[model samples]
Target: MAHSSTASDKDPLYLEAHDDDDERRNLCGTFWKRLGFVGVAVVIGVVSVLGLSIGLGLGLGLRHRDHVKFTTPAIVTVPLQSSPPSNFVLNGLKGQPPQTRVYAFNVSNALGAPDGVVRPMLVVNGMFPGPTIEANQGDRIIINVTNNMDVPTSIHWHGLFQNQTNFYDGTSGITECGIPPGQFLVYKFGRFLTFTFGEFSGTTWWHAPHESYRCAHTFTDYSTQYADGITGALIVHPSEPSPPDFPTWDQDLVVQMNDWYHTFSSQLSAAYLSPFGIDGTAGDEPVPESGTLNGLGQYGQGGNYFNFTLEPNKTYRLRLINSGSFASIRFSIDNHPLTVIEAEGTLVKPYTVSGVTIAVAQRYSVLIHTNQTVQQDGTFWMRANIQTDMFTYVVWGQNTDVRGILRYSTAPNLAAVPVAADDPGPGMSWVGDMDTSLLVPAVVDSPPERTRMYLVVVALENTADGRFLAFMNRTSWEPLSGTTSLLLVREAGLERHNATSFAPVGGSLQDGDQFYVTEDSIQVVDLLINNLDDGDHPFHLHGFRPWV
Candidate 1:
């Protein structure tokens, strides 16, 4: 893929994304491998407006959302660990110069079982459910990711606006080519070079933790690294003190929940993309054998459960992120109500509920008061149940409820704890189940008057060749071989174009796939996403949090 330079090539912004000779070779296989697994259909598109752009894409599976009202139930909360992991402790940001935080990520292959089934896994810094990346609003975050795996890989800073550093967006072939096997890439967000939290601070995550590690170089796409471990919690605290109206807690905790599979993602992807389904059910996504809370759960044989020790009569803020590749999870504790304060980083008026349902790639911040009396065994079950009803088919004896122990500091013997009798099955109504959309943001701003609009209709297409693919309108997104849309846009140079003239910007737009480039300018655009699939889809925008 030869890059044709235009007059604007010397511009500073374009220079920032320019690649060297070696990188050009790596970029060829980068995106194609990252997104190669066509097993699950995903649609990605970019719409530029207001000098910013929105990168929208569909999550794992379409979800069926049940609308529930906000409730103010009597609730309690608590955090994990005797003290916050030193790495994740939030330092004061007020009256201090911003600091640069560095994390060394060594992405490699390992073997571990989150749910008792040992399998090949991808790990970061030798830890499954990788270390927490905690930073204050304005602090710089520099993660030098070294790919020690045999395959190429990339990391996406999900939900973070890359601002001027679009190359660090970490979508192979889209932003910049992925790092090659045994190579390294420095992802800098925060400070002036790449990103600054600015006014935004909230719960968001990276895939594989950007777990879409490009697994195989074969024609099929495989990005199951996150599923086979390699994901973690990323917490960005508000630099300013909690507003007087915001919910407060004595301690903060992080819990990352996800569906677990015993098999490697590559194998599962191969089965999923096979013309014949796993068990004669074509187009049925692979059902997970179990679920995990903070990367620990159990199956028939052996596995450890995550435990959160709490002090009595204390309020805590629990940050929850669903980093799974699939499966919508219903999270709850035995005898406590969760008071929702934040949804995907937006502070909201306190809304209480017994349990909250979160889909893959979604996040929530809830405060619980640990005021409940200790159980007889001094342990409560923190249940993360897979909404198995959403699956197209069911596997026998598949345990959907993944439980963790919530023990109090006063418990006489932690080893004597028993599972809660009332821990229910999938789809069973946990008391006070609430829909996140119903919660209102603490501060609401009206969108500017729209000057343009795009309607993207999403649906599952059963192609003539007997394969199920997801499409946005008439096009399904396949990466441009060996190059990225951003690269092409840079080569061609940026120019303003109105809605009527908008067209694909990269190489020849293939008949079944498409990618577009938008000028970095102002245009208030309203995007309407219509999902025609029976299931639900969680759409995520990389750099913008749109008002839904």
Candidate 2:
């Protein structure tokens, strides 16, 4: 009985106590709390790392945006020196009025903004577009070209025929190497004959001759160094300063369209990106701006704005010139009719149109009657939007960038329109096949004062870099030659020649004049054309349209 009690009677109280102790034990509570604290610390460290990464990313993004905003376009001033002589007197012919006087000056290249920056330029009468020269039909013109810059230069009469007076053609090699720097040359020619059909008053332009190549080559980095900013207009009025018989407006606006290439850095990186190539081809470079009116750049807010005053009912003559190296412009006055009267200095039968397309070297003189109310603000815009197959090689295709304003005055007593008797209808189109017989008839018996021949030679040679090198009359203009001794040697040699024999010189022209025959009795002026595997050069003549 004692042995059995030893196994079963092993204290029920002790077993109960053991069970109670097991039930009261807090086994993993402390461990769980410690683990939770560790987890919280790890989470805080990860969150801090993420916040710093986000902050750094935001700061970098803002800095990049600010840098882009700071690179804004700026206004560049180009120094344009004046043409040398202050005054010139052109001689007269037999039975003609006395020689007319013309002022000569230069427009130098100013290197900064339009408001300041002064550079040497060759201008007539100290104006960019030379002063309008008005004369009777038979009056003679005397132009004394004075070179005041550090380079040699010449003046071309644009459309006037040299006939026997080839020396005054204004072409450096053709007439004579333009007067050297600090030198002077005089050009005298007469218009003793009357036109049979062409109108007396029209639009035209004038520019520096081949000698301008000196500047052209020197400033090749700047697209418009020699041609764009350096050029001007030449308005040859039919008669003296008598008010027009037609209704006239209070102001006459002459808008000269031009292209410019400015330097963003001293290294000419901006010019290097120019879209318009030096020889009129497409390049990978950038073109900050294209066309402008009155020397205003095409970018920036209100940088190139032109404002004009107009009465309620008066006619205004808008003379437009397509002075760019390439691109024809489509000009129009929004909500107004344009009555075109002339083209390229030749009057045409009037015609009306909503807009007109003007080709390179072409001029248009339109008479617009602003009869609308003052509330109707009008815009006279010139856009180069016409699609042409000719611009296959041009970059960005065809686009115009010139515009101006034609605002009607709010003034109470508006200007009165002249009688309709003098207001000619829309003029004829100058784009048709020109009827030679209809042009100014050849002076039947009047002996030619001078006769000269111009041979236009174009060459496009392959360059070492696989690009084509273009040249006028076989002379590849070397941009680097500006600071070289070759330029001075050429200038000194050109100065030694007789000024009279200056007609027809330069590269192949010089060689031709030396090797080709010059007969005295030829009547008609001949312009021989030869394309030397080069690109096509659109040859232009001012004042008078050349017959093909």
Candidate 3:
């Protein structure tokens, strides 16, 4: 949502560090803290910082136990298909015991031209956008990621609750030391739902996943690495039909969209982070040169449009993921109304809309009945347009309207050019949509009867040297060098540090971006986010689902 506030807070059991202004007072009541920042800000209310160390130890123990040994499977060589097959559904997986899947990925540099202009990009297993990780709920997924590139990197399993396997979170500096260049790290975790009603059932993703690091372009690097390529879809099927009777689809297809940048991610980050932001404008995020659907788009240079062929009359579930580094996308198809069913990972009551405006790192699964009569050309334009207004400055030749083809099997001319439909005008977006009540969670898991509320402000600030920096109240997050906070704290022992705060933990709060909790009991928190900045920023919790 643009220029509006949202109330979404993470689970209190697993709290990330952030600075707070209050002390241990009123152990049984609600509290509010005012924090301001320019970009995205995390509102964390910690009752016990010791959980971080405990979680990390549990995760490490799970991976290194003498009894648990993993035999690496052969890495798939073929380029990952853009969408899953028609038969990829959960019905077949029911009644089977959970199985473990092991995968190995080689992270390296390569040249790709999704828009017909080749550029150096980071890739997994020699492919852009990596590979899809498909698994049913409750399956253990062990991935061995080897760094073949010159730089060290880590892969954050976005949205997957690490639970007891917190060390496998893949967050560099916070959870574990990054996989150094030429070295590999094994990420072992289970794909389990966090809530009663299949909380993490639908579409999710995995990316470079960085919280703030010390480098100027590190923020961009988080965006850049994934933007360059290392992004992929992660589909977790529900053990049973979510909400018991929610309708199922005949075909499950993934439509991954991203705003494409021709320039190197590092250069773009440097310019955006620099004092003179791209033409003297401070804090202007680098606008993408083009947008891509399923990693392909016909833009300035020339490229193939992602095509989706379907059998008529069958209900298809389109797992839409906005894996772009920046820029929220508005997705729709000509003459097709999308019936929204899932947001991020939570399944919602079916609501139909012309289009869906998906923010970065957000996912939505919508069902579309392919009942449209076969047209002359057999095709309808699938549009994944980037919201240009979200950008501070406009690029002259930028192609915001990224299109693909949705062809029916009964069309007369499969080769004929498809006619574009009239403008849909800015359709319904989760953020800007007026009818917020329409997309209610299928199962309403109410928050605790008594909860703590925190007020946080988000804004951008210009440093003395001219660099633009984001802050929440008094501090900005910068990663601890050499070792991760979790590892450092675990090695130093939780007994040495106060359970409530990281202040006594040396080098943990030097950046002053994190806060801690002194209590051990489970507590509910309400994080009220007020976006003071100009654009629509998306905030994500690495390991837990936030009740909105």
Candidate 4:
């Protein structure tokens, strides 16, 4: 009634002070209490601010944990194999049980000499290009890999697909995480059915893809801690016991082609970057005493030198695998003619050629008649001719070297050798005549299903900064950076017209453009030549096996 102003009508500053006073009084009562309240408020504000700052710092710290500066000590393990595992034979066609066995292997680096020549690396079964696993088409195959190294390792069944039974696919992330060091992984295949014809009949291989890493052409040594030396071949033969017109045998021979590294800078650079250098600074160094057949380095050297005794007139099947990192081989006997019956593991028409060019990831089954009129010294020289281009490292510019020897006869008198029986070895033999039966064109029983095309272009770049760059399919392989996955996606997304962008901007085309795609259930890969050598590319496909 006296018109006294309400608390809301009081001066703003006075009202604010009054509210603060009320708050202080509510928090406490006496003068000492008010001071205590003010102190408590200040403490609360400080605590809140400190808590927020700490929480934000912790979040940022967690987000950057992977970026923390920390050098990981290099972990090296020298792989060892107590003994070579027993080879398996394909006996299913002969009504016999399929041969299966377990193999143990180690992966480690081979320390080089003190002269800066030897570089440590990851190897398999104590050898670069691990042991060869041989079996016939109808045989049940089981491979037990024990990773004794300090990192995770996996085996990819290149060119072989498990189809519905995807469990047998050896891809690290797609099928399994692979076997970590000190662990064993069992990869089983061929238990379901036998391959009648097509892709399964040819040469196939296995290698470690421990995660995504650079391959030959992109990186100097090819990425992956184990790629420099840890690779191998898997040859699956036809169910038929005899290889066409060839004679059978008690034992088989596996020739592994490979390249060895010595310089830490060269090896490490190649392993993590490009194998080919701009001028001559990076890539494979000439291994003075490397290169082996069955883990045996040079002939007559400490490496595995093959010395097999052949009956004067008996025939032997040579199962050859071109497992070299970047070498192409021209294999022929000194004075004997060689017959090629299969290529890439598939049965081709038995054709006699002067010499077969074995590129990377290629397999050939041939019948070498030790039947040469026996001379006291009839030596069949197996040589691997290196094929390089302008892009090839000058360090590897040398002529062919003798791979191994095929001693015709051990008899004192070379001429008195008897003709051996033509019985197909202990394995299953094909029912019909290989020449006529395999040639009869069979009718198409099913209509084709799906189709896709892939254009393969090799990219080469000689930068102004003296840097050389090379790539397959126009995409430069980024070593260990794990950028290939993204590049592959971008490649797959481009339209036909946009495909040109895939090639290197200013690089030359070592190999021309070629497209590979599946059509109507059949996968068709066409290799188009632009500037590539007349040489063939032992192109290996993963997931699905091709018949060509």
Candidate 5:
């Protein structure tokens, strides 16, 4: 959101903060304020060290909550002839297991700007919005992640069910300490997705789950890491199909989108989690700098932009992933309506929509037809608009209208941003019916009655020390020293306990607080959440994808 700019109104700080190439370090601490629960889901696609993200359950009928960090590199180091991922159609690998695959990534630091400017960033394999990693259902994957940077780091396979391999979940404190700087870890991909679709299919993502003994809860610590550049796409394919109604398309395209911050995420987090917060806005969240589609976007930046080329009258399968850590995004193409076919790896009956409102950590696969008459030399605006209403403390981006170019016959290299062309005329909007879609075949069944019901109150509260904090119930979470929660719980087998508690020692890095809950036995459970604040919030139950 660009504010009214006049030569007379310009200030050095404003000009410097706006320029990604300026040699300014953490200048945002002087500019402004906001915050969220999501890995700070990182740092809305930046990378985090130490923590591994895990999926607790993959059952017959539900999808679990994911808070893993997603990342993208700042520099555009993609070699020649690499196209955006395919969409709409089932992936090439079948879902049947009995296979193993491995990929090694060197995580390091770099300088570049996804929004066409330069800034400090974390990179995986020299590309931001990291490369797409695909595997068939039931197959094993070995992700060999090497820390090539000075800081410790890790990767959590966001939506995968780590069935028996809880240690492999990549949760730093809860699973294992992060890979030390100059160290490497081989994550043996566990068998996660076991529920086969009789006639269903969908998409999911992997992000940084910043694990920290410190700042395990808020923006001050690991939350800001992955918000910049470390997110990637993981596509699971089914081996066979029982239904004959799945739609087929010529090209499959993966469109990864999320909200972005211009200043360093740590700086944004400091402003967000500041004492009493910025300007006395105790519960306000930090507003993001802009939004991105596939790791590239330009907000009011002239010349080169992120664009997609298509052939007229051709159907392209598009997989949409919300890779941001905080802000929710709504997407729409100038003249095209999308036919959504899948949600969160679960196949549903195809539905149409003019645009979609996507929350953080959500994914959808839609089919778009390039049937529009070539206008503006076959160029149209593809908007990835941030939902400002979903947040409270938006210091900037009040007019977050991030755009890219789309053309049927134009070269992919030539594109621009926010160019105003006349509307494509009044168009129809589509509302998603998750309930109806869930009833489709291959539904996983859950036990009828819940053995235990956990009540969580989502709240924004002041700590005893007067720090403004976001939490569930009343307790702030702090990780245990030297070991993870899983190992602790496993070791406490003979000890009588309903829940566990530990206190932090004096003089540690000031981070947010987090606590934990443990179950006595394996019984079907119910989670009841009540919001104590008025603003928008996304609640996720780490470990299991439960039926909602």
Candidate 6:
């Protein structure tokens, strides 16, 4: 992985995905290790499920997606890895001077440890949890992504309107081919964007959007990718002279929370996707081994933590991001009430909350005031605890709660305040839930009458080689290969050589496979999503933010 700046040629390599043998080997090993019996008793149990039909490659009521080999035009050279540029631009979006911003990210395993535990994690610019990209609404943003790993990679700016740059949407094989190993790719934004909100910036995130049940979280091709790392927060500022709606705040804090695991994601995915469990029962999605706030936490302990310093009587706006792989967490600061200001990217009518429930991949901005006298010695605990017993996974996470500190003192990385003195504050009762129907959108929710309506049922079925497969309207999303569905349609006239040039395979079939929709004319689509799964799943529709 030597550093070079230029790349040419469409590099395509077949990913050496784990085979049945490799998968079974992991299943045999992990199930034993997970049970804490690496000795004789565990070995016998591992051998029992080795005869599963999953490895035989027979679909058990689930339609298997055909793998497509995709190719990209350019590859990036692995210039020597370096720290993030210290002087990156930050625009308030109220009326920024610069119209363009540049960002360089080296997708590599070389970086400081997240969770303070050195594991096989992918990072951006050598930063775990990645770096935040703060820019004005109208500014052009260019991101140079260099893939230094053995596998290909891609990045998706979730919730952002790609507008004219659909290829830059970053859904591998669907929008664009991935950046190959030792190669680089550039994603450019704002080419076709007309920001009506003047310099608008909103809270969004960038992560690996090439969704494979295996490697969906991380932008890499491998299954265990995101579990290792490769996610970050992005804040878009509207204009330089930002709208003066802010009554005011002294400081702004970005608080990101997630569930962590010691085991590789692939291992857990293998089990979660497998039809049979390690002990010859229905498979269960592996629970997180722990939780982290801004990439710092340990099992059942506040190892490295998210610490906040506040001057007395000052109001600080906290941007809360639920970056968990899969978990809805309740976020709250003890002895403080949160004033909800923004939901997603839209500013909401300010509302008070004792604790807010954050679903995965969701973002919120709340205002916290330092009104209370510091309890338990000038400190309070900021809690992001997983809502257990709500989700129906057979297994449970090792650590249920992750706590950080809210200190009145101005210090970076001070020794932890004594937990013995930690008071959760006359624990306020968080009853029921937030009323979403009552919450109003900052922008008017107006659209042409829905022309096409779809009732999508989200469920997990005992199919796909005997594994628990997630589906939408019985259609689960699997990556497409060769040409992207986008490219196929946009460039439909480019190639009429094949009779089925733009046709989606098995798309017309029912009950569990990827579905392709193509409307020759622009049509408003109303999707009525019915969540059949016992657990609540966060639904995010890319390309457009529809009124819910």
Top TM-score prediction, candidate number:
1
lDDT of 6 by residue, 1-548 (tens): 00111011212111221111111111111111111111110111010001111211111222222222122212222221222222111223445565676677777765333343344466776655677777766667777777777887678777775544455666654555566677776665543432222323567777864244222234334533555567777887655433456456665567777776655565655565555653244543445556777665644222445556567677877788877766667887777878777888877777777778787678888888876764636567788887654333333325566777676653233444535334354234663235555556555556557666656566666774676565655565554444444544434423442532232321322223355544333456666777665554556665555667
The alpha-carbon deviation from the true structure for residue 402 of candidate 2, after best TM-score superposition, in angstroms, is 2.3
Candidate 5, position 342, lDDT: 74
**Better candidate by TM-score, 1 or 3:** 1
Tens digit of per-residue lDDT, candidate 4, span 11-128: 1110000001111011111111010111110111000000100000111111111111122222222222111322211122333445554344555555421111234655665544
What lDDT, from 0 to 1, does candidate 2 have?
A: 0.38
lDDT of 1 at 34: 23
lDDT of 1 by residue, 1-548 (tens): 00111111111110011112222234443332221111101112352211000012234353433332122221112111111123222333343557777777777776555555566677776555676777777778877787777876777777775555556777654665576777877776533543566555888776542222222233324355667676667777777766576766777777788787766777776666556654454466776777777766667655556667677788877888888867788888877788889998788888888789897788998887777764655667778888865565555446787887777766687555555577542222554678765898777766667655667677776677776666766566554555655554544432323422223432233445653534233455566878887766677666666666
| Residue 510 Cα positional deviation in candidate 1, in Å, after optimal superposition | 4.3
lDDT per residue as tens, model 3, 450-528: 4455555555667788776665533454455545555444433345554332224213344445433211233455556
Candidate 1 vs. true structure, TM-score: 0.80
Worst 10 residues of 6 by lDDT: 41-50
Q: Could you list the CA RMSD of all candidates, in the order they appear?
A: 12.4, 34.5, 14.3, 27.0, 12.1, 14.9
Question: How far off is residue 56 in model 1, in Å?
Answer: 12
Better of 4 and 6 by lDDT: 6
User: For candidate 4, what is the lDDT?
Assistant: 0.39
- lDDT values for all models: 0.60, 0.38, 0.58, 0.39, 0.52, 0.53
Q: Model 1: runs farther than 4 Å from truth?
A: 1-97, 190-194, 209-220, 374-377, 424-431, 492-511
- TM agreement with the true structure for every prediction: 0.80, 0.54, 0.77, 0.57, 0.73, 0.73
Q: After superposition, how far is residue 140 of candidate 6 from its true place, in Å?
A: 0.9
Q: Rank by lDDT, highest first.
A: 1, 3, 6, 5, 4, 2
Off by over 4 Å in 4: 1-95, 99-101, 109-121, 127-129, 165-168, 171-178, 189-199, 210-227, 240-251, 264-290, 299-304, 388-393, 396-400, 409-458, 462-538, 543-548
